[model samples]
Target: MMQLLIVDDEQIEREGMKFILQKSFPSLEVLEARNGKMAIEIAKTIKPDLILMDIKMPGISGLEALERIMEFSTDIKFIMVTAYDTFDYMRKAIKLGASDYLLKPSKAADIVETVGKVLKEIVVDKRSRAASKRQETVIQKTRSIIEADLVTQLLFEHVHEVNVDLLIDMLEIDRNHEVFVMNVLVPDSSDHPYPLIKEKVSELGNCLVGALSGNQLPIIVFRDKNVSFRFQATSFAKKIITVKQHHEALGWFIGIGNVYSELNQVKKSYQESLVAAMEYLSPAKYRFYAEIEIVEEDFFDLRLTTLKKDIVDQIKLGQWEAIRTEVLSLVQFFEQQGASLVYSQQRILEVLWVVSRVLNDLGIEAKSPLFAFQTIDYRQLRMETGQLLDLLKQKHIHYYQQLEADNVQQIKQYIQAHSHEEISLETLSVEMGLSPIYISKLFKEKMGINYIDFLTECRIEKAKKLMQDPRRSIKEIAIEVGYHEPNYFSKVFKKMVHVSPKEYQNAIHGK
Candidate 1:
C-alpha cells in the first residue's frame, strides 16, 4: 500500500487534509506531521511515498523541509500546500522538487486529482526501475554465455570468423592486451565449486572463466599493464588455492600457462597449462608452464613444437596411425638428443597427455595417458608408450564406429532447417553429440566450407526467397532470415551476394 504524509503547522489543516485523502484513497496509509521538522523525521522513519507540506510552518519552512527530505529520499513525491498563489511562491515550490501544488482553499476533487497524479507517477517510476533491473540481469547472463562460448572457440575449436571478432569486441577486452590460460584441475569427488571460483576471479575484473569441462576449469586472464605477470598469476593462483583449501577432500591443482599477446595464440598457452598440470607429483598446489624443469634448449626446439602441433591436428582429423607415428618419432628424437630416460619418459607422457586432452575435447572419453610403470630402459619405454597409443587408438576408433555414417549430412540438414534461428557451432555440437572442434573440422573437410559459412549461405538463400515478396520490408526480411539487426544483415548480404539487401530487393522488383 502507498503511504502519504500531511505536514502543516495548524492541527485542523493537517487533520482536514488527512480526512479528505483517507476518504478519497481508502487504501492509502495517511500519516500526519504538525511541522516541517516532524515531517522530515516521519519521512526518514516511515519512508512515505508522498508528502503534502504547508508553505507556512514553525521552525522550518515548507521549502526547507522539502530540501531536507529529498536529500535522503529522492523518490518521495512532494506537493506544496499554501494559501499564497504568487508566482514567486510557485517558482520556489517547483525549484524545490515539488511534484504538484495544492492551493490552501482547493476543492476535494482538485486535492484528489493532484495527489492521484503524483501517486501514478510513483508507480510508473517503480515499474520502469524494475524493468531496467530485469534487463540488466538478462544482459549479465547473456554476457556470461558469450564469454564461455568464446573461451571454447579459442581454446578447443576453430574460431568462427563471422562472430569471433564481434564477440571479442562485445566482451570489451582489448585485443592488443596479452592473455594467458589458467587450467584448474578439480578432483571428480569434490562438489564442483565453479561459482565460488568464478566469484573469486571476478574480483580481479579481467578474467574470463570457462565452463567446467569434466575435471578441468579454464580461465583466460588479461594482462594488467601495471602488474608483473608473475605477481598477477601468483595472486590469482593463491586465491584459487584458498577456495580449494575449504574442501580438504578435493585435490585441486592449478596450471599457469605462458603469456601470449594474441588471442588466437592463447590456445598454445592452454596446451602449455595442461602440460604444466601433468606434473601431479608437484608439492605445490599450482604450477607454471615456465617452471617445467625440462632443459630449456631441448624443450624450446622449433622441431618439437611443430611436431606437438602436428599431433594435435592429427588427433582432430582422426588419423590414429599418423598420431602413433608422430608419438614414436618424438620419442626417437628425445632418445637421439641423449636426454635422460626419466626426462624422455616425462616428455613423452606430456605429449600423450596432450593427445588425451584433444580426444576429450572431441567428446571421446579417453583415460589419462600414463605408463603402467616407470621404464628403466629405452626399449621398455618404446614398448609401454606404443601400447598406450594403441589403446587410445582403439578408443578413438570405437567412438567413431558408433557414430552414424552420415553425421555431416545430419548437421547440414539441421542448419538448413534452423537457419532462421540463432545457430552456432556450440548449438550443433550439443545437438549432434559431438564437440564443436570436431564438428567444425568435419564440416569443413566434408562440406568444403566452414559450418558458419554454410549457415550464412542458408540464411542468405532464405533471405533472397523472402525478398521476392514485395510486401515485406527489408528489416522484416532480415529478421525472418535470422539476423536481428537490419544493418548487419544488409552487410552480410552485400558481402555474399555482391549487392546490398536493398539493392537486390530493388532489382528484383524493378523499383
Candidate 2:
C-alpha cells in the first residue's frame, strides 16, 4: 500500500513506467509526471516513497529539479533514468542522494529490483525510528533500552553527524575507565527473541547492556582503577557461559572483545567481539577477541574490501586477464601483511568464497576438489597461496571461455537462422548480455575475423547455395541473404568471391 511516482519528459515513457509498476505491484498506487515541473508539483502534494525519473527534460532539467526538491524533503528516494550514459549525470545524481539509476530501455526486472531495494531501506529506517521512539519513551530505565541502542549504534558505526557528547552521556561510559564489549548470539526459533537476556540484565552490576539487531545482545563492561582488565574480562566470559548453562533453552554463542582504555574505542571492542561471536557460530560457544588471526590494522585497508568488487565486475566482463592480475594482487597483499599461516590460508579461502559467490550468481558452479577449503595445510598454504588461487582461476577462465564459445556459436546460429533478417551488434548484444565492444572482440577472437566480414561471408555462401535451385529470382536470392539492393549484394559478392552473383549463378547453371 505504498505510492510510487514516474517522471519523464516523454508521455510514452511516463505511461509505460506506470503500466510496468502497476503490473509488478498490484497494490501500489502509481502516479505519472510528464515533466520536471509536474514532478515537483506532485512531490509537494503526495511526497511519494520512490520516483523513477529521466535526467534530460525540456526546462529545469531532471537533475536540477531533483536538487530543488531535495531541499525540502531529503527522505524521498529517486531512481534517475537517462538515455545518456555520461558519468557527469551519474555523479551529480549520486551527490543529490539518488537511490539508483536506470538506463533508457531498461527491463521490467531492473526497474522492479531498483524500486524494491529502496523500499526495503525505507522499512529499515522506519524500524530504527520506532526503536528510537521506544527508547525515548522510557528515559528512567537508562541501563536497558536507550543504553543498548546507543551501544549498538556505536558498534555498527551508525553514527553519522551524530552529537557524540550527548551519545557518550546517554551510554554513561567513563573516559578514564577501561571498557570492554561482549556480545552473545543465541539460537531461538520461538516467537520471543531474548527471554533470558532481559531477565539477566538486572542481575549484572554496573554494566551497560544493549540489544543489537537480530538475536545479538551486547554487554558493555567497565573496569575501574582498582580492578584489572584481565580479571574483569575473564569473569564476564565465564558469566555468559554460566547464564547459558542455567538457561539451557538459549544455546549461547559468546564473544568477548579486547580491553580498551577509552570509551571512544568501544567500536574496536565491538568489532573484536563481533569477530569472536561470528567465529563461535561455527566454532566454540565462548571465544576471546585476541584469538582471531586478523587484527584491526589489517582491516583498515579499503583496498581489501573493494578488491572483491573489482573481481566480480571483471569476471562479469569476461576479463580473465584482469581477474588473474587482481587475484595475484590480493594474495601478494596477504603475503606482505606477514600474518600467520592460518591468516593467509583463511584469506585465500575468503577469496575463493567471493569468486564462487560471483560465479554462483551467474549460474556457474566453481568445484574445487584439491582445495576443498574445509581443511587447511599449514606449510603449503602460506608460501603458495597466490599460485593456489591463481590455479583455481582456470575454472573461471574455463567458464568464461565456454560462455564466450557458446555465445559465438549462438551468434552464428542466429545469423544462420535469420539470413533474410537484419542483424546488428546492438541486437546481438541485447541477446548475449554483453556490450558491443565485447561482442566485436569476441567475434574476432573466436572466428579470426571481424563480425561484419563473417556476416557477409555467411550471406554470400547461403546465396550461392540457394542459387543452385535456379527457380528463385535474383532479387529473391538477394532478399534472402539480408540485402535490400541486388546491386549492393553483387558488389559485395564480387569483392569477396572474385565473381558477381549473376556470373556465379550463370556459371553454375552452365550458361
Local distance difference test, per candidate?
Answer: 0.81, 0.70
Which structure among the candidates has the greatest TM-score?
1
Q: Superposing all C-alpha atoms, what RMSD in Å does each candidate have to the true structure?
A: 20.8, 13.8
Candidate 1 per-residue C-alpha lDDT over 348-378 given as tens digits, one digit per residue, 9 for 90 to 100? 8777766777788679997566554557888
What residue pairs clash in candidate 2, if any at all?
148-210
Candidate 1: how many backbone clashes? 0
Task: Kindly report which residue stretches of model 1 are placed more than 4 angstroms away from their true locations once superposed.
Answer: 1-137, 245-251, 261-265, 294-322, 340-346, 357-362, 367-387, 404-511
Candidate 1 deviation (Cα RMSD):
20.8
RMSD of 2: 13.8
Candidate 2, which segments miss by more than 4 Å at Cα?
Answer: 1-290, 293-303, 306-339, 347-379, 417-436, 461-471, 484-511
